[model samples]
Target: MLRTDYKPQSIRQSGQLLQRHSSRGFRWAFTGTIIGILLVILSFNSGSLADSHASQLSTEKNKISAEPAQQQLSADKAKASIKKLPRMNIELPPDTDGRLSQDQTDIADEYENAFPRRALPLSIETSLYDESADDENPNTLTAVTVQAGDSLARIFQKQSIPARDLQNIMSLGKPVKALTKMMPGTVIEFVRDRQNTLIQIRYPLDETDTLIIDKKASGYHSKIDQVKVETELVSVNGVINDSLFLSGKAAGLSDNLIMQLAGIFGWDIDFVLDIRKGDRFTVVYEKRYAAGEFLGNGAIVAAEFVNQGKSFRAVQFVDDKGNRNYFTPEGYSMRKAFLRAPLNFLYVSSGFKRKRFHPILKRVKAHRGIDYRAPKGTPVYAAGDGKVIRSGYNKYNGNYVFIKHGEKYVTKYLHFSRRKVRTGQRVKQGQTIGYVGMTGLAEAPHLHYEFLVNGVHRNPRTVKLPQARPIDKKHRTLFTASTRSLIARLDLEDRIYLAQLDRINRQQAALSNSEISPKSAPQ
Candidate 1:
């Protein structure tokens, strides 16, 4: 409420303050109005600048309008050049069903995506064979060498071949069973048609036979085809300065060939005892081939072994009855009724003697048999075709086998670890009757072999062995006619070898003489 006592000075000051606030408000409103007007003018100028920029953009658009036509002309010229290019008309191989498989379709889709503008008919023939191959096997083949630890199923899986086809091939039973036993490094060829479908397979069974599996309308059919093998005559000769094996190896003879050589002359010469230095041998043999590739060494047509200054030659003859045997130039058989040594031995521990000191008994005793010292488990062969009379064990003789050869001769093998024949089994010559062992009353592994003639012990090494029958009288003429050239070739090869040796010796002697001769004194 208003009272008379209120101070008028305070009221006047309040009025002055109100006046000042009113003036400040007016000044702020004037400043805001000026700023608004400036903003409007700037906005108007920005609109004019935008209009000028729009007009410049319209003129640039008009200038670029002719570039589209020029670009169109260039594109037309490019199209014309593309049309003028040589069109390669490639014809893809037709499929059997006149359609692509799902896999082929997917591959084709990938090719199309890779080249979207124009996808050329891309064909990759998987065959590594020449296109000019014969019609019998016109389909290209991919060869794979079987690696170690790889099975046929694994190989087929690795090649992406259908398991059903492998099953069908195996269904052939006997013919394709050998495929499961393929050795490492065996080459298997797969022939696929244009569709990459397995059409044929070729697996070589041996040097001459190849197993071929062809996919037919019914199923896979398998067969073995043999190549024609040709036999070529070859000769090898060696002089024995050391052992026969070493000399033969030095002369480039394989182990098999060397063993064959030993077998041919083994009846007459004791390879363990009789082979001496200065001995020589000549072998005329056959080397087989199929399709220009060497197969292996074949039968020995003729051979000569000179032992202890005596020359022995044998020529092979196949009779009319298909029986093959080695015969001398005089038609005498090379085989005897009994082998000179029943087994391949390293050395003789004890010879047949009237009296000798026994290692086990430690006393002088009659050593009726020859003790052949060989490694334990060495095979002991039957000396001849004979029936076992006794096969038993004794304290003195370990595992013993006694065989009766006809009515006159008996052979006994002792100190064997085991016996192969029973009491009545007939054994052939060179048949392994038992292995060597010292089972009883012995110190080391050895075979004690004894020869009995008419119930009396004889020296097996020096005994007169019964002679084998000569070539049959009926085939004698045929044998002579067939083996004449072989003997001649053998002799000729020997003479040529001797001549070469003589020439070499002469050259060596001449060199030695020249070396030893005094050089001409310089004047």
Candidate 2:
């Protein structure tokens, strides 16, 4: 089937269709090219627009900042001009409107009402005002507490007082000597004039006495002024269960008061060895006061101590010679010639035994003295007022001291670490003669004490001591009359104490019975 005649016509139609497809492709390509060019132009225009907008904003911001900068410059210039103006202390007169005058002209008239004026420094104002006031009124008093290491001269210099004034005060001699020895916490007052000259000085010596030194026409004069003090009797009592110190403290007795009590009855009873469990004591002492304020304790008026079922009472009395002493109701003195023990001891380590084993010697020997166990360096006192006959150290006795009282009595002390007395030195009763130690022939720290009469050693514990001089016969009636009320008061206080103690004991027993009855009940 060769069809040559229809081939040309069909070919012409195909070629025309091809030419039309080519023209459509070219149109599509041209349209795409135009859209791409337009998109690029739009992007460039948007970028330029954003840049212009940002430049406008920045220009506005710069202009805004320039306004405040110019304002600040002008304000600074105004301040500089104000500072350059002259200052004067000229005061302004008040107007017809009843306004107050001001010392400064730069401030407005209404400135005082609107704002407060700045105050000057405290130190400057104080100096100026105080100077003026002192000139007007010359008298002024300055008080100072005496600090440690502060001398009178230093204190005076600190207060601007003249040295000549101190010399004048010191010229008064013994009356002003206390000022030189001023203790800490003492308050001293100085009176001065406008010229910084000292006029007077006041120092309180105690609660009731004050030493006042004043500048008079005759140099300086000093006088002690005493305040009237009222005496009050305070009674206190306590029973011992542990020790005198602890029981006295529990009864509200101060240490000084307890020691005073011990000293009053120390002649008859040894506090360390003679104290019992049920011993009781009552004391009436004087408390001094001024204007209803307590000053301090004065003296013990009367006291009673009951030991081991025996009661001892003493009352303080002043003799005609102005010597104060404690005496019994029978007009007898409470003091004795010799003390039972020469020193305060812990316990009796070794008694006076004719046949006893010695710790160091390891054999039975005659121990003529009592060994009193005590701490090292414990004070050893003289048993009676006597002269030291021998104070020396030996191989067996160690450091020893011998005191001879009159012609018949002699006391010996051995085993001392330190000797306080010398040979031929007179020592008072209760005076410290030596300190205890563990010397030669001693196993531990102890005091070996021996009492001799006519060269014969006697047991110090059982030896009878001599009584002191009694009250004078002329004052016997007065002593009895003055002491009777005190003794009766002591009896009354004892009865009251016994009653209270019985009541407490009954209450304790009842409580114990109640507690035990519940446990012992039958179930």
- Using TM-score as the measure, the top candidate is 2
Candidate 1 lDDT, 178-283, residue by residue in tens = 9889999999999998678998899999889999999999888888899999999988889898889999999888899889888888889998789899899999
User: How close is each model in CA RMSD to the real structure?
Assistant: 22.1, 26.5
Clashing residue pairs found in predicted model 2: none
Cα displacement (Å) at residue 275, model 2: 1.7
Per-prediction backbone clash count: 0, 0
Q: What's the residue-level lDDT of 165 in candidate 2?
A: 84
Candidate 2 local lDDT, 1-523, one digit each (tens): 8876665878989999999999999999999999999999999998887676566556645544565532433456556644743333444456635543453432553233223232222223454565555466668888999999999999989997778888878887898999889999999998877676778889999988999988888788999999999998889998889888899999888888998898889888878778999999999998999998988888888999999989988899986778888987677788788888888788899988888998888999989989999999999999999999999998899999999999999999999999999999999999999999988789899999999999999998878888768888898877888778888888888899999999999999999988885456676
lDDT of each: 0.86, 0.85
Minimum summed lDDT over a 10-residue window in model 1 is located at: 114-123
Please give the distance, in angstroms, between residue 507's alpha carbon in candidate 2 and its true position after superposition. Answer: 6.0
Residue 483 error, candidate 1, Å: 0.6
For model 1, state the Cα shift of residue 324 in Å.
Answer: 3.0
Candidate 1 pairs with clashing backbones: none
